[model samples]
Target: MGEAAENLNYDCNYNMFLAKIMLSNLSRPEDRQKAVKWMKKLATCNRSIEEMKLRNDFMYYLVVNIQQGELQPPFTDNPPTSPLPNIANLLPGGIAEVETNEMGEPSSTQQTKKPMLYENSPDGGAFLAAQPVPRCGAFCYLAVVAREPKHD
Candidate 1:
């Protein structure tokens, strides 16, 4: 379904409906995994996802599907290369520590503190967990994070 969304360039409402249905009916770990893959792919489709507006149902499912992949307790792993400063002000973060070289030194620096929102794994995988569970418990819904709004 995600592939279909990608193929369609997220341009069709019917395709969004189909993808939403597939995501809504997720019942197993593998199913969630697949859904997460689709969501992540959909979120980062080279800014193409920017044009895809979502309804409430689709937004809710997007959050749910991402929450499934998010590691319990939240991500504090390999920080984004250009992470925002003062992340502790954002959420109670966690990290997936990966050794830099064989010395076991943490690769992430203080300035590039990983956002508490998500983690990147050793294999260079990002967003294994759903993100944006803010400190106040408000959600950052995937659609908002997928892309920046165009300036006009």
Candidate 2:
């Protein structure tokens, strides 16, 4: 087989191995619930194949080894927070979610509001729960800097 075909075969085998480990661990109720959750998340995601593979590998390790503090969730930097006044009710309908960042503080009694569809990012691309579409954006700001740049 050619190099690409060989690599594809290897990738398929690795993914199948990961899936086997994950499925075998699902005999427990908690593990089964978690597996279902991650499967749903993986299904809805628009991440690249490499990213999905990495997550599956982590999930496989999490299932087989069950390490402490290994898979710290990236979302919910919200400190053990009280819910926004009416937001809890809206959650069932998927209409509202809490907004949090360094600048904006969430208040327990804050009025209900629709979460912004998108927000500013450090890269100015997309919000936290989103996979940033690799964009070839303008680099005009770089022109103002006086530093010499390196080419890899």
> Ten-residue segment with the worst summed lDDT in candidate 1?
71-80
Model 2 spans with C-alpha error above 4 angstroms = 1-13, 16-27, 43-46, 66-152
**Would you give me the overall lDDT of model 1?**
0.42
Candidate 1 vs. truth: CA RMSD?
19.6
TM-score of each: 0.21, 0.26
lDDT, candidates in the order shown = 0.42, 0.41
lDDT of 1 by residue, 1-152 (tens): 46644544534434445555665455556555655554444444343333343322233344544446442221222222331223223233323333354565556554554655443454332553444444224554332335778999
Ten contiguous residues minimizing lDDT sum, candidate 2:
75-84
Report the C-alpha lDDT of model 2 over 1-152, residue by residue, as the tens digit.
35544444454456445554556544455554554455444333224455444444433443443222222231112211321122232223332345545555665565764444323334433333464433234322222436778989
Clashing pairs in 1: 69-129, 70-129, 70-130, 76-94, 76-95, 77-96
